[model samples]
Every structure is written in structure tokens, then in C-alpha cells.
Target: MLHETSRRRLLTGGLATLAGLPFGGVGRASTLFDPVPPLIPIRALPDRIFRTTVCLRPFRAAGPRIESERVGRKLVVHNYGHGGSGWSLSWGSAEVAVRLAMQAGDRDIAVIGAGALGLTAALTAQRAGARVTIYTKDQFPNVRSAWATGTWSPDSRVAMANAVDAGFADRWEAMTRRSFATFQSYLGAPGDPVEWTDRYTVSDLPPEQARGFYRAQEVTGFLHMGDRIADISPRSQLLPPGSHPFPTPTVMRNSGMSFNIAMLARQLTADFLMAGGRIEPVTFFSPTELTRLKQKTIINCTGYGARALWADESIVPVRGQIAWLIPQAGVTYGLNYKSVSVLARRDGIVVQDMGPNDGFGFNDTNETVDIGAAFASVALLAELYERPVPAVSPRTDP
Candidate 1:
């Protein structure tokens, strides 16, 4: 794992370098009220970013299901299949699965998977007055949710075939709003976890392509919030339409909620345990092994593993790999170019391009994808997710 101190120093050095470098005489690293260069159209969408999009299929659990052994009859509730949005859709999805499990008429719930989805499921059950037990092969730290850029989820563009539906869009929007508010409740120093800030999303296209899901103004309310000024995200004039500094045509900019996923997960899990939630770290390869599960209700929060556990073949793998930067202090916002490349994140910068097509996997040396693809994704996401990017160069006095 990369050390925090070293990452900070690296980011500081990079910031200093940018501060001194000439960007029309201004700092090029400004996120708010700074000029955003037009996105230099880098060959089609996936061309310039994340050089490679490895299928996370390897990590995708397979079998009578991925990891299942039947020691006994353990009624299980499987919950998974949240590709990149695992952290973002965790709570909303968790609520859905938990609700189902609770209906099983059992006070004891067993949750599989330790990522954001799993952690949130455990906490929700405990809150609802249920005795929750979390069983997993790996702990929180080793889970992928801890590695996310920690952005607002529902990663709308991801692959969701058999299990999900078109109406999922509505559920996704609702979940985003609910989750954001829930996350806001735990923001503080001890949590060092969640915070709100302005995220300038720079784009080089018209509002349609730039705004993404919000491209339709009608859904903005349902998706964001009713409050045009605050509650929901709206496109404002952070910069003149044509004044965008980058090579793109237009820019979308907005401030958003962010978090240190790893820290947040740790804190949430700790709270869950304190609230009387149970944890069984022992891995059960067979469904029968779980038979000892005295709990009448079992909530399955296993991502990918759901394929075999329930014999749900609809669930497929969309691989994703994240490139973590050293860490730049005072940087809380995020940026993305299309959904392919990204740089703005709570912990640090990350470039990812793993979806249904590219094949799910990981490759560390794909830096070429980082510079271009991730950069483009940041530009696109900034304009759509947050506010519009400023046209004025950061170096400029104005």
C-alpha cells in the first residue's frame, strides 16, 4: 500500500510544479473558479483513456456459486452485482436486499461480501433491530469498495443485465439522493470520512453530451433534488460558454459530496459492531456449511458471487482497475472524462475504464490510458455531475 506521507509530499511537489509552470501565467491545478481547458478530443471515447479496460472477471466469483459449500441449511439472501458503483449504490441496494431478507421472518441476517454493499447491509439490519452476522473470505480493507474514488454512485453507465430493469434509473436517482444525505450525517473529523465541496466538471460539448443523465432537465429534480439552488445539482455559469480553456466545446461544473471510502467503511463497520451486529469471518465454500445459520433471515450482499450462489446467470462481470495517485492534500473534489478516465477523487486521482466490453481485469502499467482516458472522463463527469468548469485560466489574476 502507498504511504500517506509520501503521497502528500508527491502531490505537494506536483502542485508546486504546476504553480510555477506557465499556464498563461496562472496555476493550472485550480478546481473552482479556474479556467478549464477544452477536452482535446482524444480518439473516440475509450481510445485515449485507461489504455486498457481489464475485465474484473478474474475477481468475478463463479461456481454453484463462486464460493459456496453447504455444511448445513443456512437460508441465505444474496446481494451483489454493483460493479463500479458498489460504494455509491451500497446503501440503497442494501436497503432493497435487507428488506427482502427481513421478510423471511428471521431476526438474524447473514450478509455476504465485505464491500460497501455488505457493510451498509449490516448496518441497516442492525438499525432495523435485527441481529446481523457478516460472513466473508476477506475483511473490509481487502474489499474493492475501499479502493473506489469515493464518488456519488449509481454509476449509471455500468452493465446491469438480468437482475436490474429500466426502472432502475429511477431507483438509482432516488438512491443517490438518499445515500448522499445519509453520508452527510456522518461527516466530521473523527470520521475524517465525508465532506462537501465544489467539484468543477469541465466538458467540451453541448449540455446534452456534457450533462449526461441530467441532459434531460426534467429528471434533474428526480435525480438530484427539488432545490434548484442547493438540494439538487444544477448547471450554472462558472464560466462563459465559449470561454472554456481546454480544447472542448462546453463544460459542466458542480460541487459534490465526497468521502475517504476506506476510512468511511472502517468507521461504518465499527459502528455496526458497536450497534450489536455480528460478524463471521470464516469462509464457507458450501451452502450447507451455512446451515448452522440459526438466523431465519439471510441477506446476501455478495457481488459477482451471486452468479452461482443463486444460479443467476444474468449477472456478468465488468472488470475495473483504479490507479491511485500519491495523494494531494486539500483536494477533495473529483473529475472524469466521459466514464472512461477520471482524476478527481477524495483519496487521490484515479483512472478507470472497465465495463461490459473491455473485458474485466487489471493492468498496472496502463499509464497511457491514465493520462488521456481518465483525463477525458474527468472532464466529462465534472460538467455533468457537478458544476460547469471555469473558462478563465487559473494563472490569470481574474
Candidate 2:
């Protein structure tokens, strides 16, 4: 097994050297991002599972609504429906939402929801010299954002291509670039909340076949909009079997950002508190409730809750589930294989199946654990690494 020191070498010196060669059928090195280290193979499954949780990505076809509305004396700014990009686009979205809320000329702000978007909004507003308070049904640790895969996936199921606004690309690109810049500020900080990792896309087929495989999912109209802002993030490139490290026959690799969800939420919440922001365990059943708050300006970062609370029928829930195993500290990278993704995080190793199609999770609000899918994803990874699929360990009553 390669050590951490070797992994670093592969990512920096080794990969960079390979970039100068015409490897992976690419005629030139300029086509690839700086060489990235491959994920260390998982040798064994954990004796105990850590957790399984589901999150309904608040999806909207027209993209996130950042408009302001008048509710009695309160000026409410809607900042929900980010779909799976909630964490990835939090800072940029929050910046836009708060900027709009600031136009109300209110010295105080109320941000609903305790997820990534909410915390970021509260902190952003507070930094602008506004007294901010977060009102949510659950605290940071209990929010649905905790269940996300935590990758910098700005375009993941964000919208149907035809449904977005005419100028959506420009707006979306601005938010993505800004968010990418802001996220960098948190890198190398405490808790490894924000960090870079090599995310490999492994397959047995050739590059063309793999592209065809992914194209099958794109037929659903959920386009991969990563290219719009690809300049800000690393780009993926093919790595032929001979040069790849995974036991798989072929692989593609890229270095991208990831958030340790728990660590990120904890640190953001702490930063908000230390900056004189207050959070109340409060839930609003309807839009009218915003009038009850003394704060005249409200920024709603409620995610999927907007579907009912704000009567936003356009906001759809794309439910996603993840099965987590005990943390493999030695495994510091991630992989996308067989329509399933596995990421090594500070909290745990996350295994999730994206299903046969990209839209498989569309409108699926069911929170129940799909043990079959979870286990199957693990089995797929086990096969890729040429390791035995571990037997199921008995579960204990909670």
C-alpha cells in the first residue's frame, strides 16, 4: 500500500511528470489538470457501520429564487431550492440573498434553517454589521445537510437544462466562482473541514465507452454544467489502465474540493456564534410566521422546506441516501465507479449509489434506508479493488 508521503508524491511530482507525456491517448499534457493521486484501495470493511442518512435535495428548475417579497412589515428574501448544490453554492447564494436583504435597510436579519446555506447566510449578514439570528427546526448537527456527500458539486442535479432562465449560465457561473474562492479561505484550517482530494472515476471500459455510460444518464435533461465554471475547479482527464493505480482496468482522476460535513457545520456554527449571531430552535409552518419575528428583514434558507412553508410547488425533492462505514484514515481520496461514489471523510467513509440514471432520485422524498443499494455499492467497490466482499455483521438494537 502507498503511504501518505507517496500519495503526495503521486499527486504533485509524479502526476505532474506524467502530464508532460502523451499518456491516456491524450495528444498533450495541457488537456489534463495537474496530476492527482488515486484513492488508496479499501482492504477491508469495518466491523461496525457508523450511520445511514438521507437528504432530499431541494431542486428547482429555474434555479434558486433570490427575489424579495413583502410579508406584512417584513421583507423576506427567498434563498432556497439549491438542490444538491446547497453546500457547494452556499457562500455565493448567501452573498446574493444577503445583498438583496440588505436593500431593505434593516439592521437585523432572520435566517431560517440551520443547514449550510442558513449558517452561511447568518454569518454573511452579521459580517455586514447586521444583527443576525438563525431560526430552524433542528440544530446544525441534526440538519439534512449532514447527509450530503459534501463534494464541491455545483451542478449536481441543479436544474433541467431547458427549465433554467435565459441568463442562468452567467448568474450560475458568478455564484460558482465566488463560492469556490470563499471555500478556499477555509482550507488548511482546523478540523479539516475544507480540503482537496483526488476523486477518481474508475471503469473497466475504454474512455469512449465510459463517456457513453455517463451520457446515458445525461439523457434525462440534467446536464453537467461543470464546464461553465470548470476554470475555477480542477478538470477531470482519462488515465489508461497502465498508468492508473486502482485495480480497475481504466480510471480518470481529478483533484477537487470536499467538505467534512460535520466539521464544516460545527465550525460555521461556532463562527456565527463567536461573531455575535444568535440561533433559536424555531420552526415556521407558513410564510405568515415571518411577520411574527421582530426582525423586519428575513432571509429564507429553508432548502426543501420551502415546498410547503412557502408553497413553492416548483421546488422538488431529489432524495439521496448514503451508507457510512468507520473512517479509513489511511484512505484520503474518493472515487466514482459503477454509478456509485465512495469518499473518505474525516467523519466516515461514505458509499452511495447514484442509481442507473441521474434522475433516479428525482421527487423521491422517502427517507427509509435502502439496504440493498447500500450493500450493492459496497460490493461494487470491493470488486474493483479485487477484495472479498465482507460478510454482514449483525446489527444491535438502538
Candidate 3:
């Protein structure tokens, strides 16, 4: 992983490794960021064609809801509408939801939906000695969580900075730190469901212009309010001129974590079942149906599905599409340029464009694949890496 240095004091823990620094000196990072390392160009060849998938992210203006409310003798703990940070904050949010459910003094818990949040919350409640049963409409390859970008972006479009509650920042920090530590345990596995890689934010503009790439909501939009908890993810360091591999005048480099969602789902499912948790393939169209469940305490983690299930008008859909290119065994890193992002996962290389200011895919629930947008994303990568003419290749993973 790319190690970097920038001194700033804050709460200390096992976060030194996240910054690519030594554990003993948690406050200081290595001088790695100061020196330019050997750069490798990502081989975005044209023949690297694979399948594509798109889904809408659940966004809420007031951040994710983790409070418990009564629903006809059933205590419901809401844990949906995480926006684009669903995968990033799944475990942390699950921890909060499960803790609330535990307060109900109920040994039995029913978790709705089987996506990232649902699975994590189910596993967490089961670990707490609760008889957990997950009710979901879909699972595995069919679940929307599998369509995620699988990056460690805890605050991506989570909520408007001014719209959140006063204690939201502190709660978010606690969740981020807990989630980061939990993800670390999944590393070093053979399937590599969770791992770290160097990611670069490259831009054609000058450093000053590229840094100020947004308007009023630019900083929060670009970083997803991550600045409030920047220490959780690897700190980004500006790359010196001409030192980076990409054809960009400026680059921001950092070490970040990603999940191979399919593998992660498999692992979590197995763990849950092993821990005596149950899963039922059931669907609910309305919140009133939650009362039918045998369990007295329920946790809602339906993601975008919550909009219709709970009539939550506040939950907005931010549509996002990804073009999965054939796996390039040689390319191990990821990069973002001109709003187009490219990441190499175990299944395939994912490429998506969030627009110039990281705001293009907001409030767009269109499920249809825009051929123009898909091709434009591919074209951006082609401009940076050289390759031969395109060739047809079958799907690498089912």
C-alpha cells in the first residue's frame, strides 16, 4: 500500500496502520508521502470488456436513521438510507441498530432486507445472543448491495452538513472507527473480500483548480463529509508535478480499503448461519406487515426499498452505473479522473462516473443503462492507457 506522511493530532488507536504508518508512532506518518515512488500506469486496454450493472443508492438528508420507535407492539429500529456510504458504514450503523434493538429487552430480533446493512445488523444482533432472523426479498448476486462500488467511503452523500443533528458528527465518528476496525479483521483472507489498495485522484487542471473543483458543496460533495473523520481513511497527499503516472497535472494519493461484495456476502452469510441466525426469503410492501413477524423487535435495513415500504419520502435514490471491464491481472490499483472512477476488484474492474463535481448521479433513479455515458467512461480510461483494438470476452464471474 502507498504510505504517506502529514502530521495532525487527534484521537489515537489502531489507526496508524490505516495511514500506512507504524503502530507505535500513531501521531506521525512515515516520510513516504514526501518522496515520489515508482508509478505504474493502469493498463486500460480496449479488449478488457465485461458485464455492467447499475443500481440506485439510498440517500437521506438527515443521515441514516438508527432510532427505535414503536409499531403496534413491535419495536422497530430503522437503519436504512445510508446514501452512497452504505458499504462504508454498514457495520458501524449495524452496531448502532443492534444496540438499540438490544435495549428493547427482546431476545428475538427480526431484521428486514439482506443487503449490506441488513446482513451486518443480523450478524451483530446474533453475536449479541439474540435469536436473529433476517427477512429479505433478495439475496446474494441479486441483492442491490452487491452492485456497490465497495470502497471505504463512510460519508458519501450521507446528508447535508447543516441538516444533520448536533450529535451526528460524534456518532458518525464512533461508527466509522468501529467499522474500520471490523473491516480489518476480514483482511488477509484468501478470497480477499476486504483489502487495501492505493487510489489516486487525478485531474487535468492545476493543483489549485483541481483542489477547488466544486462550488459551495464542493468539499463535502467531493469528500462526502469525510473531512470530519478523515483519519479513518488514509490521508490524501498531493502528488508533485509530473511524478504521477496518469496524464494529469495534479494527483491526490491515498491508501484505501475496498470490498469484493460477492465474497463478503458469502462470508457474512456463512458466519451468520454458523452463529445460529436464520434468514427467510420474505418481502414486505408496507411497514404494517412488520407486525406479522414473530419477533417483537425488528430492524429495518431495506435501503432504497424503504421508500415504498415505510413511505419514507425523505429517502432519495441516487442512481449509479458501473461498466465492469475484463479483469486485468496486472492492474491492482484504482484511480479517479474527470469524475470517472476505475477500481480493480477480484471479480472485475469497475468503472463509473460520478460527474465532474461528484454530483452527477444524485436524485437520479433511472435504471436504464445510458450507452452514451457508459462509452464516455470507457473513453476516458482509453485516453490514459494504451491498448490494442477491442475483443469479445465472456463473463469472468457469475
Q: What is the C-alpha lDDT of each candidate?
A: 0.50, 0.75, 0.74
User: 1 or 3: which has the higher TM-score?
Assistant: 3
- True-structure RMSD for candidate 1: 11.5
For each candidate, give its TM-score against the true structure: 0.62, 0.87, 0.84
Tens-place lDDT per residue, model 1, 32-133, is 355544333222233323232222321212211112232346555566665545665667666766776776467777777777778898998888778878
Q: Tens digits of per-residue lDDT for model 3 on 1-398?
A: 11100101111111223345443321223344555465555555545656667889998888998888989999999999888889878889999999999985889999999999999999999888899999999998888898888777777777777678888888888888889899999999879999997777666776555544533224353224455665565556655444455555555666678898878999999999999988899988888888898899999999999898888899989888888787666566777766577778887788887664445577788988876677778887778665332332332332
Name model 2 segments beyond 4 Å from true.
1-39, 43-46, 387-398
Candidate 1 residue runs with Cα over 4 Å from true position: 1-74, 158-174, 189-191, 203-231, 236-238, 241-249, 337-340, 344-346, 353-398
Best candidate (score: lDDT)? 2
Candidate 1 has an lDDT of 0.50
What would the per-residue lDDT of candidate 2 be over residues 1-398, giving only the tens digit for each residue?
A: 11111112223433445656755434244345454444467643534356777888898988888889999988899898888788888999898999999985788899999898899999889888899989999986788888888787887777778888788888888888889999999999998999997767666665556555555554467645654764565545555433455655446666768899989899998999999888899879988878899888999988888898988999988988887877875788877777677778888888887767666788887989877677777777777778432343343334
Model 1: weakest 10-residue lDDT segment is: 1-10
Q: Given candidate 2, what's the lDDT at residue 34? A: 50
Model 3 gets an lDDT of 0.74
